[model samples]
Target: MLAGKVSLKTVRSFVLHVFVLAFSCLMIYPVLWMLSSSLKEGNEIFVNAHKLIPSVWTFSNYAEGFKGYSGQSFMVFLKNSFIVTISSVLGTVLSCTVVAYGFARISFKGAAFFFGCMMMTMMLPAEVLTIPQYIFFHKIGWVNTFAPLIIPSFFGTAFFIFLVVQFLRGLPAELDESARVDGCGHGGILFRILLPLLVPVLITVSIFKFYWTWDDFFSPLLYLTKPEMATVALALKNMSDNTFGTSWGMVFAMSIVSLAPVFLIFIALQKYIVEGISTTGMKG
Candidate 1:
């Protein structure tokens, strides 16, 4: 009877493992299919949609996609994406860290009220703000320029601010008292002490900022009307042709290229994301 019980346990574990593995494969099947389609010849893509491998792989799709619209190459769009994404990430890190330190450490007049206001903004839908934002940027002559796409990031994003605030609240207030005893001012304490410890959460913020900015299509489409100024997302959108024939192969190839940076950054920094978010609610 004991031996039979052991055998039953082993079978249950085996079944559980098989179920999880199958589910994981199902979740990733679309990505696998896209990668496979990117390598396939145009005619074979839809015809062999069920197949994961191509009989005849063609790299010409990437070449054709890179040719780009007008005279510019796809490299131009990629460069634009990098510039905006990197700048936005830097701005978010700087602004969010500073604002979070204030909310988490330094007590001030109306601090609770202001923090509540900031939290309310987090619940606000982004679409509600777009029209007014566009008008404001247009008035400032920021339309048709990278300024519209990049400048507002310097103001703290509510989500990142809240994230950092939660992480900071989890730390002991004694650190601030000790720093003050050592003749460190608020700025000095934040820069010299807390900054180092903030690495995990900061990396989390940077990864999120990079991912969102890289994938943003609407902002670029609204601001960057010039072909030379188009970002990777906008350029990919332009690749689709409804009136004529869209090049499915080229679209799939460039889609693969566009996803590469986001995938690499997330994979590299994912551990920090897990660490930062997990520890956030420990105290706060």
Candidate 2:
């Protein structure tokens, strides 16, 4: 009877594993299709749409895709994306950390009121600000420039500020008090004491900002009129030309290229993202 019971348990466990594996494969099927299609000859892509393996794999798609829609290279779009993404990440880290430090550690007149306003901004949809922001940027001659894309990041992003604030609140206030006893001013306390401990949260913020900014198509579409100024996302969209037949193989190849950085970053730093978010406010 004990042997039979053990056998039954093993069978149930095996069935569960099989079910999970099947579901995971189903979810990843489209990505697999795209990856496979990217390696296929253009004429063979749709012909064997159901097939996972290409009849004849060709690397010409990647080459063709790298040769951009206009005279520009894919590297130009890639460079533009990196400049904007890196700058915005730096700006977000600087602005959000300072704002969060103030909200979590410092007390001043109207602090609560200001914090409330900041929190309210998180509830506001980005779509609502699009038109007015465009007009404002246009009036200031910032439109059609990287200024529209990169400048706003110097101001604190509400979500990252809130994230850092939560993390800071989890830290003991005694750290600041102890730093003060060492003749450290607020700047010294923040820079010398807390900044080191903030690595995980800062990394989390950078990863989130990187992913959002890199994948962003609409913002670049709205601001970048020149082909030379296009980001990877915008360049990919522009590749689909109705005048000339859209190159599916090239599009798929570039799409895969575009996903590479985001995937690599997430794979490498996903643990920190989980750690930062999970530990936030837990101590407090």
Task: Count steric clashes of candidate 1.
Answer: 0
Q: How accurate is candidate 2 locally (lDDT)?
A: 0.89
Predicted candidate 1 versus true structure: per-residue lDDT over 81-143, tens digit per residue: 999999999999999999999999999999999999999998799999999999998898888
Clashes of each: 0, 0
lDDT of 1 at 156: 90
Q: Please, what are the lDDT tens digits per residue for candidate 2 over residues 32-84?
A: 89989999999999995979999898999999999987799999999999999
Best by lDDT: 2
How far residue 63's Cα lies from its native spot in candidate 1, in Å, is: 1.6
Model 2, which residues run further than 4 Å from truth?
A: 1-6, 275-284
TM-score of each: 0.91, 0.94
User: What is the alpha-carbon RMSD of candidate 2 to the true structure?
Assistant: 3.1
